[model samples]
Target: MTELLPAAGLTLADEILLAERLNEFVQDREAFSDNTWKQLLSVMRTGSRWASEHGRSFLPMSRADLRDYLLWLQASGRASSTVSTHAALISMLHRNAGLVPPNISPLVFRAVKKINRTAVISGERAGQAIPFRIGDLLRLDAQWSGSGRLQQVRDLAFLHVAYATLLRVSELGRLRVRDISRTADGRIVLDVAWTKTIVMTGGLIKALSDLSSQRLTEWITLSGLIAEPDAFLFGPVHRSNRATVALLNPLSTRALEDIFARAWREAGPGKDARPNKNRYRGWSGHSTRVGAAIDMALKKYSTAQIMQEGTWKKPETVMRYIRHVDAHAGAMVDLMDKYASS
Candidate 1:
């Protein structure tokens, strides 16, 4: 099941071919859970590049070599989490090929531990995306009125959906017109077909607010996506404001990020304010997700509720998103403030 792919000679097309082969293999055996072959290939390329530079082979990777690769990744200034992801990807590829991953062995596992310890000692924390919370949405809603431009309207709807569903970028991109529906009780439900963590068999459903429902309806009507049930929910509007590029073509990840940034920038009444400008620049695809989770925490929502809303598998992962708020807003801090006042 192992692939002895050329270390240095692998190119972009080769990566694609290998990924496709792996995908076909997955279809037959159902051995791997990940459907994100492109992301896997991207990680594979990093290992391949390193292997090429070091005159080493990546596919039939030795445990010692894998350990060194992790160390090299950290030494080259990659973040601790990022280094772990690199190692994890390699492990995934090995598992996909029915081989035991080197990462599980003490030889390579110790390297990962050391990397984590180093980061902790250096006070290096994993960076969370800048959240676009309820406040940001309200400001945008107040200032970004009117649906004269379809893209403007669509972007607003997109932002609302992102916040309400707490969906990852891939989930957001995969949304189709048919996925949004109104229940008999007038509740808007957005059905998530699959997620990064688990395959929902098209059963995972999320509730969107009436506010979000209205924005979505407006966008659907203006963009005429309702007529095409299978069309991408968030298609790009061309520059002329004439029409979308194509109904079937989904917006690329970069395009989605750009739309978010543009919407964020134009949300402010000033439109030229330094704060808004910086937020637009700093925000990423996960900003709304981080923002929504933090907003829930501030509202005293339980970690369990937040996990269900965001489709997170682990409480620790959810905590990571809202930990900064928790770090400052604990009961101890409130009592300390009360003591100061007394």
Candidate 2:
């Protein structure tokens, strides 16, 4: 008896069965974070709808179909990066289905290139959040220190820890009480289990400043969460009738953004100033991470040091956050000043 084999592999009784199993394995192995998955799903849905409207199928979409889709996206006022993501998502779908991806089409490539050139010529770029400066954090801390309000204490702790660790709002939201520990040096260390980077090596450790640790301790004591080790570190605070803290539930990303917005408003000049309408309009949950990177850059930390602290695998990503700061305080600025002033 002779054994049948697939074209690329060893002998198998049924090649179709092997292909099916391989497809399933590939699908299972490709995992994405919740937010990332949602974004990819959105892209997929948009692409699929476009394909359906054009009487085309997504699995074996042709290069011409993809080109048309890209043109459609551009016509619909999608950003170049967003259109690129959609193309990438379509390519991923094709690859998962064991078909050659249509991403290498010259027309699609030219479309993307044209969009980039147009954006640069028009001075268009993505909006960035205003980094939360250290001075702002200090001012907020002073105001919340003697307020004797549980929510204020929690906000103070949140702001300090956020600036210290540069944690994303999602990672901060997932923090559990048990994930934190006090070091012998009296600093608070957080064991970040879920982050965008550390999915394999268990997790990474981030340390909080002494002031942040003290504020955290006060919040925990006041919130009565010291006994509940399994509770979330940051939870909801009920302010309907009276201020009451809830620890059993984890804080949502929206809630974190609201907290940051409120802090920005309070940190500004007047009580009537609207956070969304003010200079702090772009400030959001990601501001802490951007601010921390800029702070490190202003302090003369090397690129490698900033990358390590931010847990960024790519130097280019880190550069994006600090480029503006570098423009003001970089070595070139000092050199230029020395020559120009003389």
Best TM-score among the predictions, by candidate number: 2
User: How would you encode candidate 1's per-residue C-alpha lDDT over 151-210 as one tens digit per residue?
Assistant: 788888888899998998878888988887897877679888877775756568888888
Model 1: how far is 87 from its true place, Å? 1.4
Per-residue lDDT of 38-108 in model 2, one digit per residue for the tens? 77678778888887888975546777778888878878877777888888877776565555567777877
Per-model TM-score, in order, reads: 0.82, 0.84
Candidate 1: minimum summed lDDT over ten consecutive residues — where? 269-278
Superposed on all Cα atoms, the candidates' RMSDs to the truth, in angstroms, are 5.6, 5.3
lDDT of 2 at 41: 75
Candidate 2 residue pairs in clash (backbone atoms < 3 Å): none
Once model 1 is optimally superposed onto the true structure by TM-score, how far is the C-alpha of residue 204 displaced, in angstroms?
1.6
